[model samples]
Target: MTIPTPPPGPEPLRETIARHGLDARKALGQHFLLDPGITARIAGLAGDLAGQNVVEVGPGPGGLTRALLDSEAGRVVAVEVDTRAVAIITELASRAGGRLEVIEADAMRLDLTTLCPAPRQVIANLPYNVGTPLLVGWLRQAAAWTRLTLMFQQEVAERICAAPGSAHYGRLGVLAQWTCRCGVLMHIPPGAFSPPPKVHSAVVGLIPHAHQPDAALFRAMEQVTAAAFGQRRKMLRGALKPLGGESLLAEAGIDGSRRAETLDIAEFDRLARLHMRRAAA
Candidate 1:
């Protein structure tokens, strides 16, 4: 399908920033992505947004927001906590002829499932300070989103897509992989941002599983993973001692002597399932 050209913005991004004195605040973990080519490329990673309702978080200066509008998405909801950005994008929304909706609020407190119509997809350059927490929250309700194309610090991205036995693997990897199919889409240099972050950044894509574990099982998985990885260096027998220790490992068919990092997603799932069953009994 042919993609529509992005509507022209009210003004150049730089001028808009200068006019509004929109400096990137350190407290908010703000790193503005100003390059049109990069923002467009980030938007492209979301893929065929034609009829999709897209939600973007931390849309500073509306750089990525403009690109989403260009994709001809059925609707583009830009949620920004900063009122300055909200004012800037509100102007862009006016020029967008109703395709754009700008909401001023903290993304962390908002429930995305009730925010838009499906098939819903979240595409954003998430703020560094709250990126991981927001991602963990989304993983809990992974089925609500059709896709998640998010930009996070390179290290955090590795943790999300890391495999068992790897140094980066831990609770985040277990929870993320269990809920969705995740992978790093691209690596972006620190220089890509207006005020570059000290470390590099990478984009990650997550598509929820067709058959997700129920709430009880999910909570069980959280408990098991937290306990196991809380002391990753300890053997399962010791790490999971509070949860029945060796007995729990034996019931789940996992070796008591193995470290948490040595166990894969399926093994973790087994442990969580058994833990849930035992709790119910």
Candidate 2:
């Protein structure tokens, strides 16, 4: 049986915002996506959502929310911090016949793994200010998500997929590349949003790796990378001195004089393993 569409029409997003006197809050990094073509394309980048529960971070004005519903997703649990946007999303939920749920909460603090059933795909046009931190948080618990189709500034998108030798390579690159296979699917200009951001934006798809080291080992990786890249310009010996200094590099068979930017994922894992071994000793 085909699902019934929502009654004739709902007010346009512009009108919804206007009537509510809503404007993008710079503090929240809120830039409402207003273009249906771009929104549809962003939804499409997630691939088939036929049986997937999609967690949308900021469904401002319900533009992308509407697109996701139309994408035949199994369900969408939209988490919005702004109350103004909440009303719009909630109204969309009523028309969705239960497939869409508007949750009034902060995505940063929300426990998304339990928000919906397993095989959850987190798809969102993330607020710019919080985007990187949110992505890092999700990376820490990569096993909880099946896929992450997220929007971030183009520079950030580059950092996510950057190779070891590039200028963009750093802590974000190390963690993201190690935890999942990620790539930029498409670019959306600043004009696509209601209040355009200064920087260009890109949609990224992150599919987690099947074989990740356990939590203990992952924590060690984080520690090693954090110290190595904390100053970033310092050599491994100086940066990692507190962790074990040159001995740690010797144990991992890495050069003590090299900077963090040149170390590939495998080298990072080598250092992480050494860090864990010495810790267990």
lDDT digits (tens) for residues 1-281 of candidate 1: 33233346456788888777789999999999988998899889988898899999999998999889888689999999998888888878889889899889999999987889889999999999999999988888888899999999999999999999999999999999999999999999999897999999999999999988888999999999999999988999999999889999998888999999999999999999999999999
> To one decimal, what is the Cα RMSD in angstroms of model 1 from the true structure?
4.9
lDDT of 2 by residue, 157-196 (tens): 9999999989999999899989999998999888988798
Q: lDDT per model, in order? A: 0.91, 0.90
Residue 266 displacement (Å), model 2? 0.7
How much lDDT does candidate 2 score? 0.90
Which 10 consecutive positions of candidate 2 have the poorest summed lDDT?
Answer: 1-10
Report the C-alpha displacement of residue 217, candidate 1, in angstroms.
Answer: 1.5
Q: Count the backbone clashes (under 3 Å) in each candidate.
A: 0, 0
> Distance from true position, residue 82, model 1, in Å?
0.8
Candidate 2 Cα outliers beyond 4 Å, as residue runs? 1-8
